[model samples]
Target: MEMDEDPDTLPAQRQGNIIITKYEQGHRAGAAVDMGHEQINIGKYANHLGIMQETELPPIRALEVKQRRKESKRTNKWLKMFADWPKYRNTKKLSQRVYKGIPLAVRGQAWSRLLNIDKIKSQNPGKYKAMKEKGKRSSRIIHRIQLDVSSTLQNHMMFIQRFGVRQQELCDILVAYSAYNPVSIPGQRYSWAMYPYSAWVSPEGVSTS
Candidate 1:
């Protein structure tokens, strides 16, 4: 037990005149291998669930989320201002707000208002239904729509399943558009498809219609 004596050089055990040998277990290395194996198993389990084993957010993404939350106040202000949008009639200000980018939560409503989607629908009553009815008669068009629908957003929840409601709706919409315009028939070699964009007018006074 002298301070200068090396512990490794000392005898492990002494019983009367007999010397007992000591064996050290390699527990550290064994534990490390076990941990690695457990990690692999955990990863396999996560894959079975179709998700990641860990849900930790990266530093950059966490910062982005924080920034997004901080910027939500601007979205709220715009929402309140848009309530009486017609009364103010400020397209210039609205354009500025759009250029800054709208929040994901309010993007749909904001774009709808900007594009006057309701007004457009009102102008062409039952147009969508009429087009859809015409599309139902074209088997070729339906087949093409089904083929494309199957591949659309395969990873997204809305379109992941084949023949899902969203996929069906998508097929209906695309087919309806194809039938709505004779030039863009599904069997046509090369033709322009006239859709809602056809109603849009550019600043240069050019109309797509």
Candidate 2:
């Protein structure tokens, strides 16, 4: 019953039961904790990025801790899988694992592998940088891209600012892609195509090459 145990190792029924128990406990205690001063204290330290939050209720905090622990266990599993990717790559088990969930820590790597990004980069060396430079020189689509960049993912904390880091990164990817493939139009649709990839992958790993 310890929260520290890896839920992934347990039987499906057992894992469900444990989560349900924790949720019920949190539900029962949620009202009492909301009426106390603990809510104010927890709210102050809560992460604005929404990655992690300390709830006002102790029971809910406990549930969150349990969930975080579960995610950590899953992340460790992914680390092992990534370490032996060749063996597991293109396997049904890999697909099942992805269907189960990809932990945020390894999500970018998983996506990169799935998309064959590294292979593409290898095949076309220096192409992404060259396209980026080309994108810079092209003024035809830059205005259209600029107009859509600010509105894409506007509510998300990372893209809230007019020209924030993530927004800029997104813009760069779209610009580069537009330049790399002139047939593709640069617009809101292109923003949607690059937004999630830019959001998940680090700057160094991301490319439209």
Candidate 3:
């Protein structure tokens, strides 16, 4: 096989990346900004600020919380028996602080303080309200990302195999994306797949055509 010329001079792949410069810090798409790609709203990512914070709960403190909440309800036998709510509530300052450092939980209500629960919820309230509604999507580069999905992050790829994100989110975004841009589905490019409004593309890399 013949090797192509300098290869070094080939136009850099368009992709997305985190940029840390003297003036600003943020994720930038590869070599150039792709205006055509559908961007996830800033607020969705911003709402996860608590994931980076620190928490201060000793292992023992957690157990103590369960015990205390259990003891607090003694007014009625039924109430005491039904006092399982404390195991779930966050009245204790320690628990409140602990959730700060823990990985983000999927149970929406529990992670409220940890992340901007209400704010994020409010931002996408309509999507959540419509149980059948789909997730936001992007048709900008589904083919490109799908090509790389298998080789990208093991976690993402593996999760995509096992416990993938709810399909509706991707569906809604892609359907809407198709209307905005005309990229075909990865391997199924011949068939024009129309996604719902909520389907969307994640800004994972910077690659331009």
**Which predicted model would earn the best TM-score?**
2
Which regions of candidate 2 fall more than 4 Å away from where they truly are? 1-60, 185-209
Better model by TM-score: candidate 1 vs candidate 2: 2
How well does candidate 3 score on lDDT at residue 50? Answer: 21
| Cα deviation of 13, candidate 2, in Å | 61
- Arranged by lDDT with the best first, the candidates are 2, 1, 3
Candidate No. with top lDDT: 2
**Per-residue CA lDDT of candidate 2, range 87-156, in tens?**
9899998899899978766777788888888898899898877876565544244555666665664444
**Cα-based lDDT at residue 186, candidate 3:** 54
lDDT of 1 at 121: 77
Task: Assess candidate 1 and give its TM-score to the true structure.
Answer: 0.56
What's the CA error at residue 98 for candidate 2, in Å? Answer: 0.7
Which runs in model 1 stand beyond 4 Å of their true positions? 1-61, 185-209
C-alpha RMSD between model 3 and the true structure: 17.8
Cα RMSD to native, each candidate? 28.6, 19.9, 17.8
| TM-score for each candidate, following the candidate numbering | 0.56, 0.62, 0.25
lDDT value, residue 49 of candidate 2: 37
